[model samples]
Target chain A: MNALLTSAVAGLTAAGAYALLGVCAVFTFRLVAVVNFTGAAIGTAGTFSMIGFISLGVPLWPAVVLGILVGTLAGALIGLVMTQWFSEATATTKAAVTAALLVGIVALGLRLTGGQSPKEFPTLFPGSAFRLAGVEVTVASVLTVVLALVFTLLADAFLNRTRTGLHLRALSERPMAAELLGVRVRILALLVWAVTGAFTTFALMIIAPQRSPDFMSLSLLVVPALAAALVGAFRSFPLALAGGLTIGIVEGMSSAIDGISQYRGILPFFVILAVLLWSQRGARWDEAR
Target chain B: MTRTLDVSGLVINRAGLPVVRGVSLSAQKGQISVLLGANGAGKTTLLEGLSGIIPTSGGDIALNGRSVIAARAGERARAGLSHVEQGRTVFRQLSTEENLLVGMAPGADLADAYDLFPELLNRRGVRAGLLSGGEQQMLVIARSLLTRPEVILIDEMSAGLAPVVVQRLMAAVRRLADAGLAILLVEQFAALALRIADHAYVMRRGELVYDGLPQPLLADPDRLHHLYLGDVQAA
Candidate 1:
């Protein structure tokens, strides 16, 4: 139906945001061995802080920059803890630490923002760019798609072509070996976290206005992002981008059906579950990478 | 002889248990000092401690007559101590050429690494993980060489390889020593290692059970077997 097409087109913005988050997840996990469960929560905190800055009558653009810096700082702090204490820890241990941090940040985020209350989430880009299938296409939607593609292209090039990228790839695959080879593991890890932090927050900020934005709701964007990451096996950036867009389109199509609209949030969880089971179909429970 | 790398009373602990128990050894410039031991004799631990990959509980590590005890793993590497760790820890996703470039010195040439392991040059675009075991070992050794270290610590270079590949790698190690770099080699093959070694050491239960010239030990198999009694399979 025409309604389904409109909804699918509308989902493009969320798809772009999901792609960005997925790319970030891939980047961090590849370079630093961190399965960051706090990706969305960190962005939520930063976006709320930007809203706080705007409420104080400060200009919107400066507040956005300051908020992104906060997110970067949050990521840097997490990186510091992991690098200092869990530098040699197994991947599971690192993931557990981030999961604990996510829970803590969620508690803090909810307490600060107040529960279930929707605030005015201002849009950086407003107004529709064009029309398609009797539906208006927003400039923000087009911008987000472009941003996702640009990030994917840039990340692929950096990981393959640059000296730091080679060092990062080396560090990710073999941490102890990288250190013995004279790569500054701690510094590079912090840089990866900071960059991803800035990206995730910006991704969420653009899409906030179109959604029913609450702290908990915003923090749970991690589900789809996680699904997107799973699609790439936390290794390939282009695969992650494609996965993100697909999940967003599916969610949009699901929203077109009244019965599934309320349960749309759980759609990503199912996707994540399906991906996990499918990827490990023939592999045994004891199989390890 | 000028010692390029020196460790005295080195102690490394894992899970609060001392793995390298107050071990002392030295590697002189332009010479190969072979350290032979059983699987659990802590040869790898000692090398890791010496290279600063793991913290030494108590010890003094001096490189080029200067104490490097305060340095971290990366600092030790930059200070000319290269560790080609066991398990052939090449970055799995990176290409063969990228592996060499990752830890190379500022002015180090990729061509030199390629020349050392000519087998790797043909597989420049291949991911390290996809390389055969022999080629991976070659890549790791070549990578360490690209760091331009004064002293290199190579642990178990022949872990899992064909005997011919092992022979080729041992020859490469000898060539590296001949090129004026101090080499501390921990190996499984006693006879092959001893053939190219100037000095020899045998560790048992975290202690140096034998320390002297390689000629005497190479001439006596019974004594070498006795030193490696715990792990009878080591040759």
Candidate 2:
């Protein structure tokens, strides 16, 4: 029992990462109207680039920054494509484009990154732990939690308070009307993609060290993130963040058990299914919510 | 020099068919130019083309004696063209003041809108979607007005509103014309729109069927009815 509790507590780092990624997913959905399945893959482009740079004898911090830039650029490129060709597309169409792009990105990422090969993932906060409720807690876990909370608060304030932020919100709600009112629609959309890209890469950077997982597995982390987003209906940021943490805790507890430990990665799929079924409980096929 | 908003030989296509063809018109400063048309006469498409909401296949739209046909919707708006789009396209999630601020250029005052519609003063913090139909109309018009536009293209200002509300809105539009702002208004209430309009243009089958003083159209309802009835018979 204590081992399960310890494993759940240790899962806080993954929880923080999942929460941050979920927050980014929700942000893009609300602001840019894309479900963005390519989020983790875009970050993996940076993550792999950072790994490559580190292997090439580059210093740690510079390589990480370069990796983040790569991710940001990839995100901006996707935004540009969406705005240029599919600006008026329905939400379903936009989501379809993202899902297609996700497959493309992952295939390209696997080829570019060393497929089926292991890489060393050095911990950012190695050997850093503190006693919390008789269990030693890592600083990385605390930092992830704090980062998710602070970033969410900051984003909420930005979207609600600032002038440009107001324009962004207006653009998301009414694109045609907003453009007629002189709001720069494309620029704000690119900004959203770039910012979320930076956040996703940063989140992956903190948690990647704990498990030196392969590129394909790392890129697929967008699933859990999306599951978290589904919990919030992709609208409520706080709810998505909480859903991410809970998912992580559940996965961790399951990992400690004998029967379900191997199938822990499939847990997010179940959460998404449950959320979809619950949301559609009382509605008919045509009027399904 | 008073800058006028004018379009010449404009053609617009929708779904492979020309909805508006060879249309020429102009809105002079300090005068209301009302475009009257029946339900499928392409009045909305003409207004949308002039505002650059949709693409214009052919034509030249000029503002301040310069061609703005190449400018997109955002560019045209920044170049002093404000469009109060159909169905009260106010940002529903935004507060009244925020919607007003969207059109507001930097360092400009917001009192111009409130002075025009003082009812918006108390509803400043309320979300625009929560407002009544009349209030939403006021908010959309106020939003367009805050841009300090030299010319405003209003689409169906009397759509789905009470007669009292329509009267109030027309009065405000008249006040706007009096302030030397070039006005192009599209309204379903032909009698009310003609009451204040200096010039009136009626559309039929994607072409301008009548272009003259509003007095003539108001005096002869049979002619206007015949023009409106032409399409109904054809269809």
**Per-residue error (Å), model 1, residue B109:** 1.4
Could you give the interface RMSD of each candidate, to one decimal?
Answer: 0.7, 0.8
Given candidate 2, what's the lDDT at residue B91? 88
lDDT for each residue of candidate 1 in A1-289, tens digit (9 for 90 to 100): 9989988998999999998888888888988988888898888888998999999997999999988988889888888989999988889999999989888888888889887789899999999989987899899888878888888898889987889988888898888889888999889999998888888888889988977788888888888988999999999899999999989878887899898888987888898998999988768555753
TM-score of chain B of 1: 0.95
Q: How many backbone clashes does candidate 2 have?
A: 0
What digit string (tens of lDDT, one per residue) describes model 1 on residues B1-235? Answer: 9999888998889999988888888999989999998889999989888888778899899999899999999999999999999998888888898888888898899998988889998999998999999999999999999999999999998988999999999999999999999999999999999999999999988888888899988898887988887543323
Give the TM-score of chain B in candidate 2: 0.96
As for candidate 1, its clashing pairs are: none
- What's the DockQ for every one of the candidates? 0.79, 0.77
Give the Å shift of residue A36 in candidate 1: 1.6
TM-score (chain A only) for the predictions, listed in order: 0.95, 0.95
lDDT of 2 by residue, B1-235 (tens): 3649978999999999999999998999999999998898899999899988889999899998899999989899988898998899888999999999976876557898999999999999999999999999999998888888889999998889999999999999999999999999988899999999999998987988888899977997887888776733321
